[model samples]
Target chain A: MPDDAAGRPPVPGSDEAFRALADPTRRRILDLLADHGSLTVADLVAQFPGLVASGISKHLMALRAAGLVTAVRRGRHQVYAIDADGLGRALAPWAARYEAYWAEALTRLRAASTGTAGTDPRE
Target chain B: MPDDAAGRPPVPGSDEAFRALADPTRRRILDLLADHGSLTVADLVAQFPGLVASGISKHLMALRAAGLVTAVRRGRHQVYAIDADGLGRALAPWAARYEAYWAEALTRLRAASTGTAGTDPRE
Candidate 1:
């Protein structure tokens, strides 16, 4: 579960988001969407000419599962667009919470190390 | 690698860092080390009494490999402390680069969507 300050619900799509982010290929797909707006799977496949359509499609499925992108039928093609708001909603909370926690921990650690009543001996 | 802005050497230890952070238990261990100052493995073991010594040890080993924490000899005990500076150096660049990339993408996306020559038709 995300720490309390992340404020988002634990049971929602966060696990999938994390799983999607764990792969570099998925991140690259997000980058492409972010740069080029909506594009069909063919458009994305064009960007990676060496890779077959099936592999790119697999990455797209992972991104969709993570709520990072939205797909809509455009006549014969399925167009995919970055859901920037959704990505922000999913990621910022977790990152912000961790950043805050680390900041607080560092502050406390500094205080303890510097204070006259130093709690732990540094040896 | 690391999208350029995460300037640390790719070969040094990034893959390990990513792998280490992929686990929640390891993150929690880093959290505990952060909250408290340096602690011996025994001290950490005391906190998670339900789990056996070996499990926590495994988590610690992963964190150590990732450079998130440092262990030092203190008499007969091995003390572990959060390597805040190392973590900041490792994570900040990556996060900052992504944040900048996202900011740019959002700006471009907004302009394209709002302009008279709209780049993509929302269908």
Candidate 2:
């Protein structure tokens, strides 16, 4: 969402984001953050009964490294939240390459299918 | 897009999709297909000059395995296209969990930010 993003080279964080997304537990953590907006370590730890606080903390470290989550200290509490823009930005380059192409394809498909007797997607 | 997709268990190809997404070269190939819609093996061969068609074909095989690409035999030529829905559906389960959560967060943010002189996203 940067105002000067037009000419800027894509951030190198995409690879890290992809790597971060590989694990289910990490994905679950992101889901939790994105839903709740922000939470403390205690809040996050309570949700995962199967894993201890330290275990969740270790995964949070990886998430932070990947830029998928950000932690901020407010008084005595450290709050963690999903870096939503960071993630969407990280994947934007890859998604754009496909979506831009798909848009064009859809345009052509629409034009061709207009007068056709039978339109088949598999074709 | 299946009528029965609601009750159906998640497709097993998400892992394959994630694995396929890991490689830069394969991702590039998907970009080609996504942009152009459908291309024959020869059409795809022209795009990657450094790598021969066989090399590209190998990547395509992995893409096919990942359910990201589909091949249709048209006459003597084989046409390859990005299975857009397949890729989207494969990732939907993961994205949905986060987005559904994000929607709630946004609602809360909107309500709290309405009268505030300064809104802090990091908070």
The model with the greatest lDDT is 2
When summed lDDT is taken over every stretch of 10 residues in candidate 2 chain A, the lowest stretch is A1-10
Model 2 lDDT, full chain set:
0.66
* DockQ, all candidates in order: 0.06, 0.07
Worst 10 residues of 1 chain A by lDDT: A2-11
True contacts kept of 1: 0.01
**In terms of docking quality, how is candidate 1 classified?**
incorrect
- The segments of candidate 2 whose C-alpha lies over 4 angstroms from its true place after superposition are A1-12, A42-55, A74-77, A96-123, B1-15, B40-58, B73-78, B93-123
**lDDT values, one for every candidate:** 0.64, 0.66
Q: Each candidate's TM vs. the true structure?
A: 0.61, 0.57
lDDT of 2 by residue, B1-123 (tens): 224221213335566777777665676677567557789989877766566678778888988988888989999888999887677656654543444334444455456657774322232
lDDT of 2 by residue, A1-123 (tens): 223222223336676777777665676677678778899888887876666788778889888887778999989888999887666656654553444334444555456657883533223
TM-score of candidate 2 chain B vs. the reference: 0.66
